[model samples]
Target chain A: MNWKEFFKNLKTEEQGCVPDETRREFLKIGLIITGVAAGGSLLNVVSVVAEGLATSEELSKEYPYKPHYSMVFRVDRCIDCERCVEACRQTNNVPEYGWRTKILERVDTKAVDQQRQFMPILCNHCNNPPCVRACPTQATYKDKQTGIVKMASYKCIGCKSCMSACPYDARYFNEEKRAIDKCDFCWESRLSKGMKNTACAEACPAGVRIFGDLSDPNSEVYKIVHQMGKAVWVLKPETGAKPNVFYTIG
Target chain B: MKRIIILASTLILGLSGFVLSEITEEGVKYQESEEAGGLEIIYTKPVKGVLFSHKLHVKELGLPCESCHTAIFEMEAFKSQRNPDFIMDSLYKGKYCGACHNGQTAFASNTKCATCHVGVKGLERLKKKAQVLEKK
Candidate 1:
């Protein structure tokens, strides 16, 4: 038989196989009338179905990273001292015009308690980074091991596509390096040298930046993110970059 | 003719007053010396490097020289470091910068370690800047 006739025959067989009212009446009278009698057997069927669904669900629920290197900003603690910026510049050999990290001053005279606040910003090191996708030569790509978005300086063509694609305004063109430069969580300068934290996080006198492995349960980053009764959020979450950098009040 | 000249001079004086008021309204004040601005003091006692800006305190915060100069800190630079108690503990005890930086008046001396503590790197930067200024 052709495909249409085969589907018609399959539908007829399915309808004929199912006993209509007798099965419905048995479920209603026998199952509904006896609470404890039918309840245990129904629960077993429900649990079996749930287990089957959970096994299939595990494929999509798996986390992408092993270490999952991430950073968090305790935003309210920042004082706009620019010490983190200076430390980053000195450690990374960043030129005067460019900065890998920066502190943005927000002043509102009408604000209660505090009229001025500072926001420290840097590369978010997103799980789905737009810069990695935008780079034509694969100059900017996420590290497979640590998941840090890093630069392969030689492959960079200075096209500036990654600069435009970045939602956080993180990337800057370096004249001396002749490539796009951004915060690589100090992997090149410090992490490779066995240092535990980024220069910016270490330089923060206010305890503003908390950098740690997100995958580690004992890490400060994981604790802050997983903690209850705390409002932790990421910047521009609607962009779907899945940024690893988190922000909170304290 | 005398009445007309008086009217003309009064008009000129009124216009000058308007112009002078506009200048003052912009918050432009004449400084007696260039040293009154951009003055940085580095502390290297218990810590490697710490920075204090005179412009922020004197100009922005509107604090007078007497607020810190001879009271909380001595007039001489790096003199506080000579004392054995010139550390964060001292600051917490309301000594040195702790008098104002007690978290009530300003940020607590105990908090924001990197804000003032520029570390050894900041000290090197200051030295480089001084060298460049000396060359100029």
Candidate 2:
């Protein structure tokens, strides 16, 4: 309607009607609801577009699809050489006492009481990572591209939140750096030219550690994971990290 | 009881529709990525009921797999964007449906709107056409 007509209508309206407080409240509520509905409709479109963009196969492909990289430690082959342990220290240049990676010895004496067997232990990089969610500073991030759980040593305030939160004791507080340091799957080394595998996998003389993409059907790691089946059980499966690292559970 | 049944049916129908749509969207991605020869495939589109012609186009165009299907949708039943609007854009940009439908390489986008967005023209007609073609 024209401004003149609108003004005339306004003037003609019942003047003494101070809409009751209840009515005013109702009107305010109604307006708020209307505003929210309008906003939601626009937001829905944006949300749909955003979701589409995020999941679009095109966008997912931009990050070159490397097979889901993972490591498997065969307990039987691991001689408890501490080679993998020492190699990780020397490679990463970890401090004298500080350890980025270490070997845990598990003794299974129920069946064979005297034969105390040993298995190397470290961070079983979980699939549905818990450490990632607990970090408030996002100091811990699982790489969407590589599926590697990475620790931001610089961003870390040495809160020790991750240390306590880790079920596996895989995380250690770097007293020197004043940050949490943990196994990165030797990402820096693997990413370097001509390095086809992680340091631990490469250093193992027995070829006990088989490393490859778990997703690739053709990959040796994938074949072993599927073929070994029930015999291959991961440590702390109850924790539900869906750890990429599987152990030979004999 | 009737109302409950109706609500339950509605929910079931909604879920089925969602799943069916998702399946179709992924299928489109897979078809688009197929290629042949050395000329890279730049795009692909799975027209409604048409058997996705990945290999056919590859041979016809003498194209490579990456050119048309730039995404990793090389596998069967590739996942499409969840949003219909973005799905529309992907088709337009030669990503999902656009991979093959853009005017330059394939049919123009407008020429094939009903392949996806069926308006008043009744999808039944398209369904009938697809059925008849299948019989042949």
**Per-residue accuracy of model 2 over A10-77 as CA lDDT, tens digit each:** 32112224357645653443433223333322211111112234322333233223656777666665
Cα displacement (Å) at residue A193, model 2: 4.0
lDDT (10s digit) by residue, model 2, range B11-46: 998886422112222232222222332211111122
How far out, in Å, is residue B20 in model 2?
Answer: 80
For model 1 the interface RMSD, in Å, equals 7.2
Cα lDDT of model 1 by residue, A1-250, tens digit: 1222332332211234447765464344333222334332322111112222332223123436667788889887775556788899999999998989876554455765445455778998988787899899999999998889999999999999888778777889999989999999999999999999999999876688999987677788777765544556666543446677877776
Encode model 1's per-residue lDDT on B34-56: one tens digit a residue.
Answer: 45543566655454456777766
Give the lDDT of residue A101 in candidate 1: 89
Off by over 4 Å in 2: A1-65, A108-114, A192-194, A228-230, B1-136
Candidate 2 whole-model C-alpha lDDT, 0 to 1: 0.52
Score candidate 1 by TM-score against the native. Answer: 0.58
Name model 1 segments beyond 4 Å from true. Answer: A1-61, B1-89, B97-136
**Worst window of 10 by summed lDDT in candidate 2 chain B:** B38-47
